[model samples]
Target chain A: MTPRLFQRTASAVLVVLITVSVLFPLAWMAIAGFKGRNEVLRSPFQFFPDMWRFDNYVDIARDPEFTRAMGVTFAGALIFTALSLVVNSLAAYAFARLEFRGKRFWWVYCVMPMFIPMMAILLTSFMVVTKLGMLNTMAVLIIPGVASGAQMFFIRQFYLGFPVAVEEAAMIDGASRWQIFLKLFLPQSAAPFVVMGIASYLAFWNAYVWPILTITDPNLTQIMQFLGTFRSARGNDWGMLMAGSTLASLPTILLLLVFQRFIVNGVRISGIK
Target chain B: MALTPTLAPGPQTADAGRSARGRRGRVKTPPHRRDNRTAYLMIAPMVILLGIFVMWPLVYSVYLSTYEINFYRGSTFVGLQFYRYVLESPDFWHSIVVGLYYSALTVPAMIIIALLLASFIKTLSRRAAAFMKTTVYLPTVVSTVVASVLFVLIYQDEGVANWLLSLISFGPVNWLNDPQLALPAIAVPGIWLGFGLTTLILLAALLDIPESYYEQAALDGAGFFARLWYVTLPLLKNVLLYLFVTGFTLAIQMIDLPLIMTNGGPSEATNTPNLYIFNTFRDVTPYATSYSLTASLLLFVVIGAISAVVFRLVRSDKAIDG
Candidate 1:
């Protein structure tokens, strides 16, 4: 074979290998969710289930704690997303457009949290939240993350790229600073807002450690918290675990499918993680 | 018309905005003058939240590390005793070693795999590349805990993994149950769920390379491997460096996988420092809180040092220029 033909064959094989390795686990999870309890742990494992058990999902649906956890997690994520969008974008606008005393100083001060890894402060932040009597409350989940240096920085960069002509045009129309920001700048920033919104929502939804520390009440448990605890308690029940994990991953998966463009952009822009 | 003098472009804003200032003819202040009150109001929420929660806690962690907490009586100032104790503890050192081990397993492997997959994918048809990219990235949206649960099933003795080995005429292996195999077993899922994003990022970098570089190399009779080594890799140096530093730091701090999969078990082979600190916090004792805090700070300092050394070693002024 020619060198080019060999290379093409190798590329094809690698592509198939990469795709299967990447997806086979997820496909297993989805398939296993439909298997009967005995079938999941059956020796010389069967790739396909004898009977597709929809009752696994039915069990999840009948679970009040699971439903409540889903509600609480979704509500908290939405609220957090809204709050971070407002708070971070406001700060981003100020950093991008407004000039003030100690601009450099305060900018550094606001974005300083980026320098400290969250794990380093996790213990003390838990203590602080506990001291404020916010443990087991949704406020603990939402409040601490509302002010994000990374989001502020990202939005600031986006805003800086905006043409200055629009703002000047708005100013000539006798708009106040508030009017220009509220009416002009904010609307024009829909793309970054969508990016930040999806990012914040996903962060809140996918959070594990902090939720475990702060929320012990089953009703207040986040989805990941619920899944983690459930996985341990029901260690032998592979069917239930797969069902719950599928349910847990559904929203984010759906979001990715629907908002592929924005999510990919967000990942590209915030590539550190 | 630039009624808001703050809209001017530079430190020397008066001259730049003079055209608009003259058009508006309503300038009553210096061109560089800013609306301090508006800026202050705009930034108030972030400043206040970050101060009370983020900044204050960082400082307070240092303070908490110095003092020992006693729930029965009260807290007392120990003045770095906890720090010294934690630093000297063999378990603390073991946890650090485990963290380093995990990073060693993850960082380079992920980078190389990602690099190869990305460069290969770059040669595909655009449609095929898009399909590959989407499939690879699909798992990234799954929460870490959920992925761990899926892997827990996959790594079971009677699970798909062992069944696959059976296909190759190998015996079933205890993946998470064996001390020797557990850490590496756990790293499999970490790489599985992780490298997709890295591949996507690297693929983007690969696509950005100018065709002329490859053409230039081919004109000099460079083979595929030579062209890749000389042209492609050098152009991707900054991005690779950035990914390496960030990926290594993140890997060393891994908690979700170990915490869920092994709980740092099989003779504590997978107990990352973050896991050790977490376990200490959960199983509280008189000085557990302070010990955990000190350990956390130490780990942070080590991570800082590692990042700094890598950045220093790769001290290209263009390290993050893209």
Candidate 2:
């Protein structure tokens, strides 16, 4: 083969290899979820289960704790994301549109949380959460995270990216700044709101440490956290574990399938680039 | 024109509206700075929330770091002693080495893999490029715990590797359990998770590379490596440095995988500082996990050093530019 053909072929193979490396483990996970305990341990050729075990799904679902964890995750994700949208966007809007005293300071403090590594802050935040006697509740979990840097930054980016003509028109109409913000600016920021909203949903959905940190109540844990219980359990059942993991991953997978375009656009805007 | 009356600029006329309020039962509205007040009110929720949750807690962490006290219980103050202890701890030193080791493994591997993928993907049609990019990034959105759990099942003893190994007449390598291999095993999943984002970044960057550079190199009959070294690498130096800092920062805080898969297991071999802090706080208590003051203090210094290092790298780069 010519050198060019060889290079193209080599590149094609590498691309396929990278894709397989990323996706294969996930495929293995799906395969394992259906595998029997014996099959899970079999030779490589028999890696796919001879018989699919449907019982693990029923067993995991039958557990009341898992169901409750679902409730917690939904509540936590919804309330926290909403609260963050309201709170951080307000500040974000203010910074983007308002001529406030100490605007720079407000902007700094608003986005400062992004820098305080969770490792550095979680230790003290836990203490505060403990001292406040708000443990074992999703309320605290949702509330603390409601003022996040990522959300504020994204919302502010949206606000900054918005056109000034609308604000000027609002002023001409004698609309108050708040009126302009609520009625004018917000309506135009749907793109970023969607982005921030999905990011918040996924973040809250994926969060583990905070719930495990703040809430010890077995009942209040999110689905992800409940799934994590398998990790610490003695003699991990690979089949049952993968089944739980597969189920836990389903919503997110479904999310991607549905909103992949929105997610990509959102990720681009949200600095995941 | 009517709004100018609201200004009431002259001192003599400032009280005129107040005195005239009796004559007009419907009092003229006080000069309304509605815009400023509304802006302030709009931002108040975020300000209060951030102050209490992020800013205050971070300050309190820094404050707590300076003292000598037990977090779970109560204690007296001894300023800077905790920093000294944290500086002195063998575990803390080990953590630094381990963090650097993980970053050392991840950043270089990720860059190379990302570059390879970007170059490969660039050769694809636009529609195909988009699909491939999406597929690669799809894993990033999955919760880390879920990903970690998935990998754990694959890495299990008598699991996929062993099954595959028997076909090749090779022994099942203890992928995760062995102390010597545990960190690398964990690091592999991390690199997998990381490579897509980096690939996308580099690809986006590569698309912007002036065609002239490649044209010039092609005319010279330069090999791919030569083009990469002579053209791509120098142009991408700043972005590469930025990724180095950002990727290193995130990798240093490796928590979810260790938490979900190993919990720093087999002998704390994968015990990252986050997990260690987690263990200290919740080693016993469910909610009041960070009760150990010393543990909290130690983590502060450790993370602070990391932050300083990352910041210093950026600053030095800026200095060099200046």
Candidate 3:
């Protein structure tokens, strides 16, 4: 083979190195989760458990705090994702189609919030949630996140590109603005909405800080942060943590599997270009 | 003046124009009711949610930022005192310097590596491209916390990383344990997670370049680096700018890795502004630590200012690009 082929082959090898480096930890963690405590620490080559601890799953499932936190996480993430969809879709339509005063100003302001750090507002957000007596509730958990800057920008960009002829033709009839919007605009904008849905779902699902801030009740803690407490310096069980970690990742992976096309498209179509 | 009337054109032209201009919201005749319904139906959900969640909370945050408001049992009308305190803090200053330092280190590294990787991908066969993309993007899909846990294991004294170094006759560097190595160690996983997507994006940007440009460059006797430096780099200018601006803003807002991996360890060597926010919010409160209103406001001002500068510069570039 030519030097060009050799170069390409070498580059692929480098990628494989990077890929193995990235995936090895995950494989190790998963394997170690099933291993006995001694095997996990003493031996590096033990790829699987000597005695498969299917019991770890049962052990974790029986823990009330674990199950409750998992429930809260699922509920909060799901609700936040739903709220984001509704808010993003509606605002996107207005920005795309409405001829309101200060539309440009509104658009800029809407997108500006997206750039603000969660850290910047995290403190104030925590205060707001507590003040409203919504602390530890999914109300606090899901509500604030609905105002997604990226989602608005995305939907707005997507809608801007969509053909406007359909809506105008609908308007030519006696249909009201609401009728045209619901009947005409939204049906065609499924492409973006689905994209935003997947992105928001994954984001809210993986989020850690906001949930940790707002939730004081163990019962209300999200699974990921709850799993964080297991990272003790001492003799904590790796099996339980890994088992929990594995469970924690399943929903997101499953969701991604179901919406691979849209999720990939969402990331691809994220920018204004 | 004639300019006054022209400047404030009537809505009638817009209404009339809407019918002829586009198709998405178009409807049957009796234009007034049809248009009104179309506007409302399309606009209601997004507006209401944005208002209730985004707008209201935003106003409240600003309001809280003005007052010395704790989560519970304490309140005072401080009149930007929180912002004042935040501006004065030593840690705040440190976070700013460190945040920029981290971004400066990470973004360029990712971009250069991503470009090279993308160049490689463009040369791959179709089957190879698909497999390569999937492998590359896998890290991104994994949760940062889980990755953090995995890394802590790798960086442990008995871990693989140190073990490899020993074999090579180089003394083992305590990666996460040592303050100096902690920042780079913390940054590595993010680069690993980030490189794949950037590679794919630049590859798309690369694919848009016609093969004719390369042939012309070859005919002109420009070497690979010369062709890339002169032709490919210039064409990728806009994409690069986009990457830089977005990359810079995101690096400043980074929370996950520092929060999980180091917990800003080794005497706060890796403490990021975002991690500081969490610490303030969730710290060991003897009697419920005050709401991070002041700290948050400062962060908001800092982040908002940074984003504004980035966006302003990029917008001007966009105008030029257009």
Candidate 4:
């Protein structure tokens, strides 16, 4: 066999192996959600369910805890995304376009948080919110994270790439600075906003540690937090848990399918969370 | 004289077309003054939020770490004592070791796997590569909560993992329930959840390499391995170091899996430093709060030191590259 052919075959095998390793567990989760309780835990586990069950999903849909958590999480994440887009872009636009005193110092100040380990702040943030009597409130969950150093950095990079001529043309049209930002820059920055918005939304959806620390009220529980405690409370209900996880993951999966490049581009622009 | 407005452009565009009506310039403040006011106003929300939540908390934690607080009796100052206590605690040290162990397991392994996968995918057709990339990256979008539950189910005695083991005549292994096997068990999902991002990042780096370099290496009688060793690895040094520092920092704070699956489990084997400190906070005693705060500060120092070392490494590399 030629060396090139051998190399090609090896690459193919690696791709196949990785693809299976990734997809198999996801497949298992989706498939197991349809299995009965007995089938899920049965010895010498059957690869496929004997009889498919929609009851797990149906029961989950009707579960008040599940539905309420979903609603609260959706609303909280939406508020966070909107506020983050505005706050991050406002600062990013200034950094990219405007000249101010202490510009360098402020930029450094904004980016410094990204360098700090999140755990170091976790305890203190809880303490601060507790001291302020905001504990167990969605405000605590959403407001504290609205100003992100990474988002500003990513958005600022996007803004820096904008053609100066566009801004010049807008300025020449008798637009105030605010009008230029709101009317022109915001509309033109749709791509970055969408990417950052999706990223922020998904992040808030997946947030566990903060919600776990701040919220003890079950009624205020976010989806991830609810799913976690639900797992422990509903122990041995593998079917229900799988169904819960599937329900939780659906939005992100749908978002990924629709906006693969935006998600990928978001990662490329900002390394990782 | 036709009065022209001298439009003061930004410093970045200092060379812009400067012919304008100088007469209108008399009526306005300098352009930078207008900019300074608007910029400050625009950035006010972020600055205020970060200052209150992030920066203030950092300082407050330091203050909290120094004192022994009792709500009924008021707070008492014991400077450096809590720090000493945290530094001396065997459990604290053990948790640090556990965090390091988790990092050791996941960081290098993820980098190596990602590098290899990136290289392999580089060999594939673009369409096939995109399919594989998306498939691998799919899990990244799945939250840790969901991933943990999935793995918990998979690692069960009667689950697919044991069934696969039985194919080789091995018995069922206690994965998360066993103290010895627990951290490593958790690391498997960590790798799965993270490697895709690293692969995609590395693949982008790999794709950026000029193909002419490879063709030139081939002309010099370089085999596949020779070319890869001489040509590829050096170019990838910066990206690898970046992944190293960030990934290590990320792995050291491993809490979500342990929180959900093991709850720092069997013998407290999977308890990372952050998890240990969190549990300490839950103790709710004055000493516990101070100890946890001090320990968290120490964790910050460890991460800071790691970052500093990477920065030095990068600086030295830039010098050598130059």
Encode model 4's per-residue lDDT on A43-120: one tens digit a residue. Answer: 987878888889999998899999999999999988989998999899998877777777768988887877667777
Which ranges in model 4 have alpha carbons more than 4 Å from their true place?
Answer: A1-14, A267-273, B1-34, B319-322
True-structure lDDT of candidate 2? 0.69
What ranking of all candidate models by TM-score puts the best one first?
4, 1, 2, 3
lDDT of 1 at A20: 86
| Chain A superposition TM-score per model | 0.91, 0.88, 0.87, 0.91
Chain B, candidate 4: TM-score: 0.88
Name the better of 1 and 4 by DockQ.
1
| Per-candidate clashes, comma-separated | 0, 5, 40, 5
Predict model 4's lDDT versus the native: 0.81
Give the per-residue lDDT of model 2 (tens digit) for A77-183: 78876776777677778766666455557767766566556776677777787888888876677777777665666676556667788778778888877788788
Q: Each candidate's fnat, in order?
A: 0.58, 0.46, 0.26, 0.52
Task: Provide the lDDT at A37 for model 3.
Answer: 55
Q: Interface RMSDs of all predictions? A: 9.1, 13.7, 10.7, 11.5
lDDT of 2 at B157: 69
Q: lDDT of model 2 at residue B309?
A: 79
TM-score of each: 0.91, 0.85, 0.83, 0.91
The digit string of per-residue lDDT tens for model 1 on A131-166 reads 999998899999998998878877776676678898
Q: Score the docking of each candidate (DockQ).
A: 0.49, 0.41, 0.31, 0.47
Q: Find the 10 residues in a row with the least total lDDT in model 2 chain B.
A: B1-10
TM-score of 3: 0.83
